[model samples]
Target: MDDKDRELMDRYVYQVVRRLPKDQRDDVSMELKELIGDMAEEKGSVREALVALGDPAEFAKKYAGESRYLIGPLYIDTYWKVLKIALMCVLIAVFSITLAQGIIERYEPGLFTDLGSIIGFFTHIFSTTLSSTISSALGVFATVTIVFMVMEHYKVDLDEGKNVVWTIDDLSKKEPGSKANVTGMSAEWTPDRLTPVPGKKAMLPRGDSIADIVFSVIFGAILIFTPYILGVVWFIEDDEIGKGVMTIPIFNLDKWNLILPVFLISLLAGLTDAILRVIIGRYNLKVMVSSIVSGFIQIVCWIIALKVLPIWNPNFGNELRRFIDSEFGAMDFATYFDPVRFSNIILVLAIFGLAVEMIVTVVRTLRYGLDEGKAR
Candidate 1:
């Protein structure tokens, strides 16, 4: 109601307006100031005007809706929609591959048993790894596209008020190869005299060539090999079937020959995926290096497993003896350590690693993409 109260309201409006986008911020602030002034005049009291305008926080929220970065609202909305669809498509493709593998194993067991077996082993080894790679690539692509579209939609001028427009006469005044200016040598061409061009916003890294491909491949390979190496170490430490009686399946030692090839193929596939990502987009070298280190750490785990398992249980050695004897009987250690348990453990580890890698890759890709867009 009073001049004091109107001044307080003016301060409140100014604070709220400060948070808005710079391009339109001044206009919006001026409009708000004028609106408050008129409301105060009509209501006779600033408190009455404030009550009519509703809560200050709520008023701020209303204006907040107008604030956005270079990316317009429509583009952000569409980008998310398309991204979800693309992700769903990728998921469907993976599921279809899995289902096809299952069908081949079941219905045509005799027709392609050998081929099916080989395929099945590889499918298990690299399913999670491939999924992770695909997800990361998709995330990066989405980020880049969104950024590109935003830069296109909004003609964001970083220099804004600082841009200096030079006239034709100003350029002509500087003689063809003159050492000094036309201002009687008093005007020196210092660094400050030349207005700096605005720096471009950083954009997502783009892997547009062969070098990127190679980097991705190397990174992926390490990731794939790390787990298999761990598994091998686990196998070697508990080689005597009796030690893993409670965890392994009832298959001949000969059947395990399948695992070696599976591991190798998985390693190769992982390497390929990594290479593809590097080739297609930018990624952090640190992350790839860390993954390699993780693989080595996995080997150490295997060495630990070898030493620790036997010491943990006194019955470990005796269990092997019992398993050997029971082979002649109906009950055997092989039956105790079923294929399901072994597969489950391997799958769990693979899935965990895949998840971690995917998360890191996606986050990095998005950040790089956003930065690149800002630069542009």
Candidate 2:
């Protein structure tokens, strides 16, 4: 009837309904509100109505019915949540180790000189890593599932002794959110414990993050192990024959070694960004900050790779000139292509691309995190 009474009634209804499954929450909430209102009218006060209903937790358990599985409904939510996190970590660790082993075993000096060799190299590594990861993944899933099942059977609480049994007083006070207070698994369930449903823009695609991880590993490997594989292929005109194909290495190995650290730092930053995206599964201020930092580091690496370090082969021009002169008389290779100018152009393009990515990340963060009020 009064504002305070109305507030108490709403809080009581929320406590009961929030314990139900997502599909049942809305229907049960409407039913609970109507029931509470009728009871309150008869009882002369909302407090009296709530007391007659008994503890919201126990009332919800009755509605939830009995469990038919090893893990009851009470522990099912937490079991799945913990299981997913554990499996993800296991997969990441397995995949990383397998990939590293394959790469190290296959990699050798001047191993990937051509496109075919490069493709084969990566294909081998990918196939080997996939094969190794599958068995490990199965084992991890089984182990995690068994652990959770045992916990459920034993009536184990993740909170241990921290959370006491729910009481009527809990309905009157809001508790701060804590991971230890998982719904159904602990006695700290409150309306505030419910997470906001993520908007479309807030969600990060797992596929994209996975692709980023694979690409970053491969690209970083290329930078460290096979920089010379990236090259310019040209044709020299020949009088006797039609033409001869020549391949010239793009990056100078000597100079590349010097700037390798900078390139690796950039790769590390990018990998961190991808890992965070996969773990969080949503775009927020933290993910936005990571993206910005990753972009900045990559831009710096590109500048160093293309400008500060003499990574490009200085002898490329003369080498092309010698090959052309042997057949077509005399030619100035600089007139056709200047590696320095090309490097500058690439640096500019790389910076532009990174800038665009950072802007998009910031915009998504604002739209999903700020506008939707779901920053977490």
Candidate 3:
């Protein structure tokens, strides 16, 4: 057969296998491909071989070996997979929100001075976050399980309609004397309608997308609620009052009023990328475009916040210097180091990191677009 015929066969196999459970997809794909090859060889026409297989949905149902239960064997594996994804997402969200709230409520200047307070602070937040996460997890588990059970019990095919039953008549309909439309199945069921099988390397792991969601929420929360956490802390020796703690904030508090919106935009961009990644489930042109857009927005926002705006605390260098000199005796701090320049360096590094991420996404998508489970 020609390349076009081979492509058609692959598409037909993809249609059948993709409807099966995730763990079964690869094995079924290989089996279906081999079966098609054998059938085509016997029939002398790939198209005829596919027609003998009947509707892909019908073929998949037979191959799936479905069983009737609260959650049938046909859907149990997929139900578990969905449950895990939902639970992880809820866990990340609850933990990040809980930690952010804790930071906002408990974080103060020199709060880290005492090792005991540090331990206590973490202990309290961990306990609170754990309890919250567990509660949220239970709710997520119940919701996902119920939804899957209902779908399974009803034999609902989401790709079709709710409780859809395609009869022989549905498959037999055809225009009178129309040679091209001989079968009951619609012409739309042809291999041309099949989606390209996503390459193995191109597949976007749900865990990675979920991780992006978690990090975006966490970093955004840190930026919005506790920007002062990223700062320098020191202690002062007071002859009468004993050792006192001090802090020099890294960012200009007033400038945060302007920088925050830009940061929010970046955060939204990251979330959009992550959500798209999860939905698409693979590296493709669309996913690459999203990654680039998100990375660009983040890089631009960082540049604006770090370089164009006076986001860096104006007196960070001076205040830190005074604290250092007073505590450690006379010493040249500014001559040796500069906080503003250091922040600029960090911005440069961040930009580099973001750029690399975009490039990697593009390269991975292109490199794997054609692999298409051949190695598997």
Candidate 4:
């Protein structure tokens, strides 16, 4: 081979080697150089050597395959997997805390209230410090381990002889139906189309199932107690122990009117998101559909609660006097309908629904747009 050809081959190999993990880069470079040199000796020319080594693009692919535990082609290009796992951890922590608090209030009653100081004390400990560290460590470890394990299971090692048995360019140059052409074509095309991507078979833990309920209950208790502990400490610091003790009941007791709506919305959103993800397998569709559906449901519920509930009376004085003097005396008929108060309540709820829907719609649209842009 000519000096120029040799230099080109070395440079090409170096470029491929540079892409490999630092630990393996130098060794891979030396190995590739040796392999190319041996091929050149047998072929007797630089052009022949290059042909045997295969297309530079194809060669680079083969080089990557040498790593038995490569996460992905774009592993270095992006940290999306890391980000996703981190987000999941935060979600778990939040869910844990919320669920624990709810359960404690339900079953333990005054226990949570009495331990307000403990809850207050631990709120900062769990939310800000302990939860953050634990979640981060678990997220990173789990993400990395899962990615690498899946990659290895798929036999994505670059150095493996099976991956680079032949090249596409080499196959195209050969006559159709030739043994070399067939083998090369099969090797280059079949792996991607036939073999499912690593991690595709693995099942992610869903927060909707019985398992989630169990986890939430167990973790929720811990989180609820954390806040009360903190509250006690707060009271001690403020020199208002009596007020703090009284505040425990209000703090720990779950207000069904408030908690129910939020829980329903969140649960519905999560289910909708999961369903959309399964249907579309795209971020844009999942986010948009989930947001819209959840928002719509929330608005409908608000409307019903505002319009259907008979809790206010507009003309209390006149209606009460008439009822008192009527044949059906002492009946509380006027108390049933309060046009002024009812209208005000309905208006407030309607406005709230409208605002929520608008916010959700805008957010979903933006998320969809961003995802599409990324795909493009």
- Candidate 2 weakest ten by summed lDDT: 166-175
Output the TM-score of candidate 2.
0.48
Question: Which regions of candidate 4 are displaced past 4 Å?
Answer: 1-67, 74-136, 139-287, 297-376
Q: Which candidate, 2 or 4, has the higher lDDT?
A: 2
TM-scores, one per candidate: 0.29, 0.48, 0.53, 0.30
lDDT of 4 by residue, 1-376 (tens): 6789789888878777766668888788888788788887889876677777766766666766646335544232223433453345445665556544433433322334667756864564456555544665576667656754564567443222243211221221221222323333444433233322213222222333333333433333343345342221212113343232211221222333443444355445434444333222322322354556665665665554445543232334454445355434666654354554655776687658656754654565564423221212
Model 2, range 189-232, lDDT digits (tens) per residue?
Answer: 55645446667777888888777776776677567655654675
What's the lDDT for residue 207 in model 2?
Answer: 84
Query: lDDT of all predictions, in order shown?
Result: 0.44, 0.69, 0.71, 0.46
Predicted model with the maximum TM-score: 3
Candidate 1: global Cα-lDDT?
A: 0.44
- Quantify how close model 1 is to the true structure by its C-alpha RMSD in Å: 17.5
- Where does candidate 3 stray beyond 4 Å? 1-90, 93-187, 234-246, 333-340, 370-376
User: Which candidate number would show the highest lDDT if scored against the true structure?
Assistant: 3
| Weakest lDDT window of 10 consecutive positions for candidate 3 | 167-176
In angstroms, give how far residue 171 of model 4 lies from its true place.
32
For model 4 the local lDDT of residue 165 reads 17
TM-score of 1: 0.29
